[model samples]
Target: MSSQAEHPKTSSSPVQNSIPASSCPQKRTFSACDLNCKTIENKIRKKIKHSWKRILKVCKEKDISNVGEIPVSDFLDIAGKFNLDLSEGESNQITAKYDSKKNGTFAYYDFLQSCVLFLKPKETSLMKRVIIQKPQKPLSPGPQTTSFFSATLRIQPKILHCWRPMERTFKSHDETRSGLLNVSDFKQVLHDYNIDLAEEDLFNILEYYDKNLTSKISYYDFLQAFIQ
Candidate 1:
């Protein structure tokens, strides 16, 4: 009777023993491959910014009309020229992603504008919307133009696959060792390679490649266009 009632044994709640949800570590959403890709992209971006002035100069040189558009091949060349060291796959991905017009050319100025936010995060005001005007329609293709178009479509795939041998062939044909070939030499080289393009087709091809109508073909540039 003198003994005090035993205090009820207090049971600890399960919640009291568990760690708080906010204090628990979060599950990672990115895999190793994702992290690696992100690292590579960051490196590329930094290189691009570091070579900004040089890149702009090259772009200006290519974009003679100040139209802010350049062929995809030239873009890739500029990347290589400046030692950006983009892989073929990386270059392809970039062109596919940024070629908004899907016209085999990219609005490089617009592209730079888009990259400004990533390149210079502090310059948010530079992220203005660019109204890309539709490129002017090329004049109607004559018979030679048509033949050239067909020939290019057929030969480009082969050139991509056998670039080294094709390059050697082109260099072998260059008697001047100047990395250029006149129309006749180019046609002869194509014939030697069994490409079988017509004379008009060859002329049209040269016309397309010779942006300045220089009456000479930079075979290296032509091959680069196809290989890329």
Candidate 2:
């Protein structure tokens, strides 16, 4: 049996930082530039380390906060809780990562959150190394075309519990103006990872609960399964 009282699991894929197009230009890129892709690369690596450590703390304690998205204050709170004395502006890179949440490396944050909320300890090895398509097709000319990254992390079945709701409430107007994710979508995600849970598993979970139980699955239900 697992050592912890809870069986929740989480895993996240790795990511390579993107060079801000405005930041890295051919004519302006000399030897020293703060926003240089190389500089950003180093900053990204450090940020990943810092972010991973903060996230790891929560996973170890089995605390599910931010609904999966780890915020800046939460990062600091976790660091403080563990007595991890990081310097001021220490999380600047991470903050930058989140700031770029809309455009830059946003996929990383999304992918990482899935990892944190759904993976188990035994599955971590699956993400240790992965191949990412380098953005060789440069948008501009310069020394900025040689870097792009990706990695995979597997979530063990032992650490996860997910559910699905019967009906999906969508905004119907825009992708941005969205509603809960349906079970089928969540199942498709699992299918991509080749993680299979028999229909019996779903039925068994719902057999007991009267309110939380549902005849179908929704993104919200899937999330509910984890926190419960």
Candidate 3:
């Protein structure tokens, strides 16, 4: 990957839910006797219900669970009500994941929810724009023999043994250097794992070796570096 082309990339779904809407209080369990706060809470509750209905309708079509699927349209409606905006994507090639088609909807909803709860609208509209430049004639990354992306990455809490046995914690592109292992880690974690990764991806994988550094990434944001 060219150093000049490498740019910091991130998944912005989860962080959007950490912040409470401007109309919502910090605490979710306040007594009703506190009428002032209760009024604000009530509004948030009602809004969630109304927004969820419109969002969930689309997810039902995909026959997937509700853990992550929520339409972006519904999320934007709620965020706008609170004068907030939650944005994601890299101006091109927007990416995200879920268990099934339904999950994709929920993931979108989750992203918007997190943003509304935590972030404020930007001074200049926190927007994601697209300027589709002309192709300038078709261009090939390089010779067809070698794929433009030479690296693959997989991240998970632990390895599963349902398909086979487990030995290590994490695996990467280097293992696929050989063509002999067809039924290897190549299929399960990389191809269908829902990582429609960029061709020239860049990011660092930081192993949690030190107990003291319990978690490096914060609730506000996350970072992933994949060099491909």
Q: Pick the candidate with the highest TM-score.
A: 1
lDDT of each: 0.51, 0.33, 0.26
lDDT of 2 by residue, 29-65 (tens): 4344334433444444434443654445463344242
- Residues 69-178 of candidate 3 have per-residue lDDT tens digits of 44535444545555323233310111122112422232443332332221222222222231112122222111111011111112221111111121111122224322
Task: Tell me model 1's lDDT, rounded to 2 decimals.
Answer: 0.51
> Model 1 over residues 1-228: C-alpha lDDT tens digits?
111111112243111121111111124233543344345456576575556556766887897765556888999988888787888866765655445456666556544433322211121222123111111332222222322333454565456566667667777666556666666666666676677764545545654555455455666555543421
TM-score of each: 0.35, 0.25, 0.19
Error of 1 at 57 (Å): 40
Of 1 and 2, the candidate ranking higher by lDDT: 1
For every model shown, the clashing-pair count is 0, 13, 17
Q: How do all the candidates rank in terms of TM-score, highest first?
A: 1, 2, 3
Q: Cα RMSDs of all predictions? A: 31.0, 17.2, 19.1
Q: TM-score of the candidate numbered 3?
A: 0.19
